[model samples]
Target: MFLEVGGNRSTRRKPTVTRENMQTHQRDREMLIWSNPGVEPTTSLLGSQSSNHLATMQSVMYELMSELNDRSEDLERQMLSLEQRVEQLTAGFNALPAHLSATLSAQHAALVHLLRERDSRDYHRAAGGGGASDAGAVVAVVPLSPASPLTHIPSLQLLRYKLPLLRKRPPQCQL
Candidate 1:
């Protein structure tokens, strides 16, 4: 009796069984068993390939993580530098009004001194005297005039009219 094994080729085989034919049939059976979908491949055959793929993926992930960490650190440093710069600018801005006020005070003192000297010269001339020979040595007192523009405009009002021009506008951000 002939037993059909593989395909149509097995149907044309002689009914007699020989040793070489038995070995060939065993090898074909072994191939079929190994190729079956239900059978799992041997771990020894797949181990090196899977490990190599996993190692490559791990190295790539490590490199990406390192790059991300470096960028984050760089951004942090930049933010810190920006904050320090802002602090310096804020200090300068806070001191500006005091500096300007001191300068205006000095100018006002000089102007008052000049006006007093002019008033003294006028008084001496009206009293039928020539210009003072030692004008630098003279300390003259002058009465305040109610009609002066300076008396009408206070320093605080001047600052109010001018200070808004120094204010910074908000920055517009684009998407």
Candidate 2:
């Protein structure tokens, strides 16, 4: 028999298979088998091992997917909880201004009532069981100081202007 040599296409004579070369080849094949005992050099055995590895890899991928899904669900629940809390806070914030206005108005009315009661008491004391002329002639005026709480109120801006006039008048009774 003849074998083609490279791209040259030259026909080379077949090598003579000596007994010694055949023995060497057999020894090399035996050594390869001996290196890994009980491991058959068969396509079927290799295919089965490859299939087992593929199954194990698929199972691992499924487990990872399940864990990812569970984590995503937990995060979604937490996000919904946070959104609910934010809505509650927003509602409270929206109602705050009206509640504050009501509180300020109540305080203003209480202050006005107190002032009127004080003025009434002062007028009665000046009258001293006398006629209406004594009550009209004697005027009891209270001086508003800069440090008073009324100065801090935005709605009581007119009171700051009226304070000077009250200060100019002399008090009938000093309390």
Best model number under lDDT = 2
RMSD of 1: 13.9
Model 2, 49-122: lDDT tens per residue? 99999999999999999999999999999999999999999999877766665655555455444545555666
Best by TM-score: 2
Candidate no. 1 TM-score: 0.50
Tens-digit lDDT track of model 1 for 44-118? 347678899999999999999999999999999999999999999999997776666565555544644653455
Per-prediction TM-score: 0.50, 0.52
Any idea how many clashes model 2 has?
A: 0
lDDT of each: 0.59, 0.60
* lDDT score, candidate 2, position 27: 91
For each candidate in turn, give its C-alpha RMSD to the true structure in angstroms: 13.9, 11.9
Q: Compute the lDDT for candidate 1.
A: 0.59
